[model samples]
Target: MFLRVLGLLICFHVSIVSATELLVEKQAFSIDNFATFNGNVIEEVTVGWESYGELNEEKSNAILITHYFSGTSHAAGKYSPDDPQPGYWDAIIGPGKAIDTNKFFVISSDTLINAGVHDPNVITTGPASINPATGKPYGLNFPVVTIRDFVNVQKALVESLGISKLHAVIGPSMGSMQAIEWATAYPDWVERMVSVIGMAQTDAWTTLALEHWALPIRLDPDWNNGNYYGSTPPLQGLTHSLMLITQQALYPDFINQIQPQHSPLEQAPLNDINASHSAVQWLHVAAAQRATIMDANHILYLVRACQLFLAGHSGSLEEGLSKVKAKSLFLPASSDLLLMPYMARLAHDTLARLGKSTQYAEINGIQGHLDGVYQVQQQAEKIKQFLEN
Candidate 1:
């Protein structure tokens, strides 16, 4: 009886290990030296990324997981047993989960502009960081980038892994932007696609929100014209930026769940009250929350890139969207004020008219734009059923 009980326990553990969790891993890839976009030619580039599951013999089962503005490559499950935060989408990507590892392999990559200005743990190469050749941060000198540029880099990464094509490219918010771009930019590279709470073009309201988020950072005296590095860096600037963004990215419904009675700011008192109290207090908490965890410069870079995204920048919206040949799934969030559903509705109609296989579903959740993230379970199940069908 004892031996039988031990055997049963061992079998359960193996099953859990093989079918419940992903063995997430990381790798470095090099991009082509002359990858050009938006009228700029990058000589060479290296992108950092993480992968969940194993690529099959044919590499056709690969699923690309693009991340949002402040997100890293860590998509689902814990990086390590001692890691504090579970994978960003702990509920979704896992063995035997909605995006079942037993059937599909998953890959998520960190963008070039990653966390922090001076943090060594973050392997990011961006405008704010020093140019290895010049011994100076790229600063304002960094060449402007666009959504298409991001897709180009990802393509390089995918090719490096010997993946001739992708089964699906899926992401939430900013990631959704990349996913959409991937479908159009390299139609032959993907078989299917999914985008959550995003649109081909950013609305004016969305651009205004982004501008406001950048305002406080720009107003801070410590900004030092984007040259602050060694000394007291732009803590005030970054903090204010984070605070504004935190407030903007959230819906009243979502915040109400985390802090029922008051805002995250109201919970704490003003530190003896000063002229800079309103900005400092709120921005301080916001900065601290995102500071070490993410790079301010990277956030600004991605957001600025997002503002430049226009589905038809290369041609007419109809012509540009017509480039996509992959079957698509569009999940627009209900109450998303930033990328309004109207735009997504337009995209669906445009694609349908273009003769591409496309489907659009407005997810019914209280998360506003964040329905793409917070409601992943329902979203994942929907996707699972769709993909299976």
Candidate 2:
């Protein structure tokens, strides 16, 4: 049983764990006439998925990795030797690393309305995707997607592979929400869940925080209420949104080192209102580079989906989590300012109080929320131990 459960958590914290490399391919999963929780229907839905290792005959070794809000299906490996970086979790998902692909079949996929639509590697159908009916972008016409919607799509992908149950579902940030949803919505399919930088519910505080991400995009003149598909895309608003996301995702301690702050007497910003600090300029350059490949509407839709998140959409946290049957672990970053650690603890305490098997741990790092990604190795053994026990 321990061996079986160990397969549940095999991919996370990419590129820093070990030097193992696994070549991977991005594949597609498509289903027609899919119905959503809101009674809306997508005539055709397609998403990109990538897998590592081999699936056992019984398919019990399968583990599904849900990507974060800013991530994609390429959980590990380089598409080619010349590619710059491996997938986000390459360090952990390789043949002999913590995920140990040699022992477990690992799958990770892009979600609906993924932020990286313009990136050639990402394949997802969203507002950015053209509608067959109109032969144009869906834009605002796209149905509101919920975290449950993401899980349902994943379930479809899993079933198409002839897998009846998952050894585990693991993810960080938004990925955590999807993992938790999977446990509640299909308790029988998930045996274990590891949520890093995760929360069982988006509280009132979080809902508003998520709204802040959408505010800039909505305020963009080019947005035109999400109607900028064929016209000039809302680059300005998208840039600001990305900037906000980057700042919120990192702690000051880590960010303080990224760019050196110039002295007031040395920089022109002190004398001129038009001039700005180097740090501000640095973030703008970075955000502009990233904005080119991201869609403004997709970011807004993702934010709305996150704002509406309530675990299984069960109306309340208690009712939503009451459906979970998996052994759960919550790992929140101690320095995180966004999605503060207490949210995870609140969920953990609730689960324990309800007699559900659960565990909690804090990852300490200077990167704050990003620690859940770059610093997960700090708790790799703890995760391995949880899977084993």
Candidate 3:
């Protein structure tokens, strides 16, 4: 009996390991002279993407998962168990998790001008890519893109995969913007959607906030008007910009708890700014570390794109939203100051008033905007239920 029980335990362990072993693959698609919203054209554009699970014969179970700013197509599973971290949404995507890889075919892709282009895991067409016309880096020459442009690119990718209908479209933060755009742009194609910590339009406050993210990079001498491709990148300015973003990305209370003794701004008389022992130092270290691996031009472009985001660019918000035929779910973080729960609330209220099929819930967590991904488990069951319904 003891030997039989031990054998069963070994089999269980092996099954668990096999279940969590996920393979992330990168694929690319190209289009010639893709038109931009700004009326300009990219002579040649490539989109990078990854997929999980298998598409059934009917192809009716395909779900599109969009990425947030600074995110890649790696949304679930691990390249290796020893990896520092799994894909951003590993907690809620797997064989039996919220997204349920066994039941749905999951697909995610890197956005054009994606911020993590410097990272090996991501591929993007941005300032770093050489211009077909000049045989040099586009630098600032790359045409400005919009959320709609992103949606259009993904739409092409979807059609390329022979998928005519999406089981669902889901995302958080910037990804949510894409999901919302998909619903508005192709209402008949999407069956349902989950938009978390996002807005239908870039409000005045959000626009100002995005400007701050770009201001520091613009001030960097090495930025050289977005033409600094071969020279030393603007590490200092990028670091400062990321530092500013970090403060708003996470809850202040959470930061305080982590570094209780370090004040963010405690100055000493007759001392250099660097001589202070404050949480600002920690923020600087963290930001500087990240800035080392991210491109300044990419961040600037993405920020500009975010500033121009509107659910309905060519028409009124009501007119645009009224086009959505999919049942929707909105999950706003209770403590999210960056995106703010109110934005989600407004979308929810609008949909409710329209008598559209919708549900609204706030994710209660201490991580603020980061909670959408970091604390996703808290709402995983609810998400599973919604997806199943």
Q: What is the lDDT of candidate 3?
A: 0.82
lDDT of 3 at 210: 90
Candidate number that wins on TM-score, 1 or 3:
3
Alpha-carbon local distance difference test for all models: 0.68, 0.83, 0.82
Specify the highest-lDDT model's number.
2
Clashing pairs in 1: 115-295, 116-295
Clashing pairs in 2: 10-99, 14-89, 15-91
lDDT of 2 by residue, 1-389 (tens): 00000001123232345544578888999999989889999999999999999999989999999988988888788887666567766656677666778878999989998998899999999999989999999999999989999999999999999999998899989999999999999999999999989898888988887888889899989999889977998899888888788888878976676555655564578779898887777777778778888898988889988888888796689998888999999999999888899999988998898899999999998878878877777787787777656
TM-score, every prediction: 0.86, 0.94, 0.92
- Which candidate, 1 or 2, has the higher TM-score? 2
Cα deviation of 148 in candidate 1 (Å)? 1.2
The ten-residue window of minimal lDDT in model 3 covers 1-10
Candidate 2 segments exceeding 4 Å error: 1-18, 264-266
lDDT of 2 at 6: 9
